[model samples]
Target: MNSDRLFTRFAIGINAAWLTLFALVPIILILIVSFLKPDPNFFVLMHFSPRSYLTLINPIYLKVFARSLLLALITAGCCLCIGYPFAFILAQLKTRFKPLLLLLVIIPFWTSSLLRSYAMVILLEAHGILNSFLLRWHIISQPLHLLYTNTAVLIGLVYCLLPFMILPLYANIEKLDLRLIEAARDLGASHLQAFGKVIIPLTLPGIISGTVLVLLPAMTLFYIPDLLGGAKSLLLGNLIQMQFLYTGNWPQGSAVSIALTVLMSLLLLLYLRLIPKAQRSQPL
Candidate 1:
């Protein structure tokens, strides 16, 4: 028993150390950098200022923030709508082929996201497969210009972040006690009523988990917009990338990064706090 206790403590200590060294250290460094002054000639000047945070209030930066929030919200909502149904169906399936269906979901992840973005470009381009198929079918007189639009960006965001949403939801849904659903139905609840009173409450944790997974990434995935959406719109991720890589403005970049980290941390805290409450309220 003492040996087991020692092993548990040792494992927890290792995890704490790992988080401190990797997560806490990087965040502290970024926070410090966010307050530093930018220099055109140097990486950063010695002078300290809050100019980076101040710059975030600029109209252009505010616009980017708004866009990022809107896109992330929409992406999460879409993923929930898509993923919940998929996860529910996948979880409730009893066939021997269930694993094969789940494998198909995992298959897309095997390909590089960059490669998939390029594939989206090819499909979305004017002379590409989608347009060609549409044109061949006389769907339109002319090839529709689908690239470089908000719709295109949303498509890319949803496509890439969907799996993140689905996996978490699946994990939760699979553990659900289907007997509760059956009991609800037996108690004269309509299908919709049973779902509303039964499935959703139990799956609240999964919904939150999936939303966080999709929402956070949607706000910060730079390449999908760059490649698939033609860089017409900039999200927070693009803004951060431009500040650090293109403009060499590391302070502003760090500020954006810090802002993102704080936002993510808040989401995580909420998720952690809410899960227990959800579990407590869960119908037995």
Candidate 2:
């Protein structure tokens, strides 16, 4: 018994050490690099400085940050709006059909996100199937500027992240006791009232989780915005990319990355405050 207990403790320590090395170390390195001054050549860091952080306050970066935030919020909102219904349906389905419905939701994730965005570009372009079909149906006089627009980016993002939103919601809604809803109805509450007062509160944790999952990735996404929104519609991700590749300013890029990381951490903290302790303690 003593040997078994000792081995268990040793294994836990080893796993914790591994996580610290792989995850914590990289984050610390990035934070350190963000405060360093870039050299004239090779964009190498020579010494620690606060100038990189000061540059983060420039109007251009601030605007990009705001735009990214708005985009993320909109994406999360749309995901919730669309995902909740599907999740509700899935939760009410027969046990045998649940796996099939989940498969349908998860199928898109098997493909690369980059490839999926490119496919959206092909589908939404002027001569693409969407426009062609609309023209054939006489829905429009001409192909609209659907590609290379913010709307296109939003469409692609929602498609990619929808599964993340739906799965969590379905899990939570499945665990919800249907008897409570039935009881509310028996007490003369309307369906809307029952849902608003009972269902929404119970499912709030899943909603918050899905929102965070979508928003965090959406804010930092570069490829979707680059492919669909075009170079002209810049977001924070694009700005960071530019600093690294176009401007060759490693320190500035690292600073932008660090700032985004901090902002996301803060958002996650706020999200945690909204969820009930019981719901949050559930396994993801």
Candidate 3:
């Protein structure tokens, strides 16, 4: 009994240490830095100031924040629309072939996300394969301008975040009790009614999980816009990147980072409230 107790305490201690080192420490450091006065030559001054947070209220930065929020919402919505149907189909597959279908979903992840974004660049370029094929079929008199547009950025985000949406949805749908659907049907629920009243309620957790996963990353993945949408399509991620890397404004960058983290936390809390009280108490 003592040995098992010791082992459990040891595991807890290790996890606490890991969280302190990786999560808590970084957040504390960023919070501290966000209040520091930035110096162009020295990076930051020891003096405490709220200038970094004050700068966030500027109209230009507010616009960027709104744009990032809009893009993240659009990306998450698109992923849900695409992923739900795909996940439903996947869940209906035979047990023997299910692994193969899941493997296909996982295949694209083997390559770096940056590499995948670059590949989109090639495909969306004016004279790229899509446009060339369209022109060959006389679809248009000239190649369409597909790259360096909001559409391109949306495409890249959807492509990158699709897997995050699908995996959670598939897990939830796979665990659904089909008998409950049949019972609902026997009660005179039509196909759409059963789906709306039964399947959707049961799968709500997965939908929430997938949306949170896609939305958080979409808000911060600046590279997709940089590669596909160009400088004209700057988002909050780009703003943060420019502050730290090019402008050497650590305080402002840290402030942005903290703001984003807080926003995500609040959003997550709101999403949790939508879950059933019982489910909220259970493991995700």
Q: Estimate, for each residue in 50-161, the C-alpha lDDT of model 3 and write its tens digit.
A: 9999989999888899999999999999999999999999998877988988999999999999999999988989989889999999998899999999899999999999
Q: Residue-wise lDDT of candidate 2 within 178-201, one digit each (tens)? A: 999999999999999999999999
* Of 1 and 3, the candidate ranking higher by TM-score: 3
Give Cα-based local distance difference scores for all models: 0.87, 0.88, 0.91
lDDT for residue 89 in candidate 2, whole number 0-100: 86
Give candidate 2's root-mean-square deviation (CA, Å).
2.7
Q: Candidate 1 vs candidate 2: which has greater lDDT?
A: 2
Can you write out model 1's per-residue Cα lDDT over 1-284, one digit (the tens) per residue?
Answer: 99999999999999999999999998898889899999888979888999999888899888888888888999999889998999999998999999899888889999988898889889989999999999999998799898888788888889988888888888889899989989999999999999999999988888888888788888888888788777878888888888989899899999998888888899889877878864534221
- Order of candidate numbers by TM-score, starting with the best: 2, 3, 1
Clashing pairs in 1: none
Off by over 4 Å in 3: 1-24, 276-284
TM-score leader: 2
